[model samples]
Target: MENPSYWAVVPASVRYDKKLRANAKLLYAEITALCNKQGYCSASNEYFAGLYDLSKKTIGELISQLARCGYVRLDIVRDERQVVVERRIWCAIESPFLPADPPPKNQGTSPENSGDPPPKNREYIKENKTSINNTPLPPTGAGIFAAYAGEHAGLLEALQGFEEMRKAKRKPMTDRARGMLLRRLQDLAPNDPAMQVRILDQSTFKCWLTVFPLDTDKPAAPNPQNDRRQVTNGWID
Candidate 1:
């Protein structure tokens, strides 16, 4: 299930940690996002492995690395037989949703001469509607991207790359242009977010203003022997 409402925060310490691998950092970010709802994540290794197209063993290793760095805590549950049953991972840092510390007691007060600072004489300048339309324009593209992309990080990153490519080519995309580009990308890969990512990445790499259709390729023949031996081992959550 996808949760688009939650946002992840990785503190500077975790991002700059040299001991953690890039994928491990990404996993930490995922954990933080999951923790937003309940202060801890109960997702299994199989779930993360499938999400990232990696093996369960690899996901386990990454989680272990995060635990070893003191960035996360793992709680394991066992039954009467001493068999491992449930596992939960919690972030060590304070929850982002918690209220901030209160301001200092002497904040905004002065013993000798303080009330509010003296108000400066205010001069209201007339609005210039004719020569300069100084009214702030809404951020159209950002809103559109958020609405369309939701919490899909891969798609968002790919779109960002396309935007960067436009800037590098000295033809930065305007809000309308970016919105149109996103619509076109969706039409090109209607049901597939992964395909949309590939399309955007291809256009960015080739510095093309418009996206192109992917080439049609024949499917490779499958081997029955290999398929039969490709069973995944069962893992405890």
Candidate 2:
């Protein structure tokens, strides 16, 4: 279900509008440049406008739209001039397994072997009554909207990963996220008395740690007087 190919997920700007196409390209380029460099966590649309020789309003609108679509994000910091916005441009790393199935093969089990249409398929076709019937619906608050889930399932992992890289303050697999997940599962589970949250042996906490910093307040380990000697001697509890 996970797809890493750049083409797999439609870019927000692409799905958005022709009006944004040009600015989106320019904005993303600047974002990449800023992230590559050090000492710049927050930036203003003015700075980008000046860089691209465009109006600040255009830059502001583009950045805001990108942030909303998850193509890029903003980080706010208190400053005298204006609130700085750090961009998180969404980039896809290609997966080797993108083309999963083999190419269509000419075989005997073709139009002839297709004896009759499936009953379930026919029933589904009959139920296609409304414009909203078959189409994927947006996620609802009553539950993790099925529409939201289906649309996002492929990128649930990617989104989680990006969140971790961009904002480690909120961990993906931390106790907090896990606790929320467990509570949701409990609410959704059938009313069976024995049902419970089961932690399987094969499951490890490492996967969820993709986006978390263990303890930001904690300092690095102190260097000992016998640092080199300690390596030869195993650590003592």
What is the per-residue lDDT of model 2 for residues 153-190, given as tens digits with 9 covering 90 to 100?
Answer: 32234333333443454433443443344344335332
Cα lDDT of model 1 by residue, 61-122, tens digit: 89989989988888765433222344667777653331112113575665222322122301
Collision count for each candidate, in order: 0, 2
**Deviation (Å) of 38 in candidate 1:** 4.3
Instruction: After superposing candidate 2 on the true structure, give the runs of residues whose Cα lies further than 4 Å from its correct spot.
Output: 1-19, 37-41, 79-237
**Which residue pairs clash in candidate 2?**
73-88, 164-211
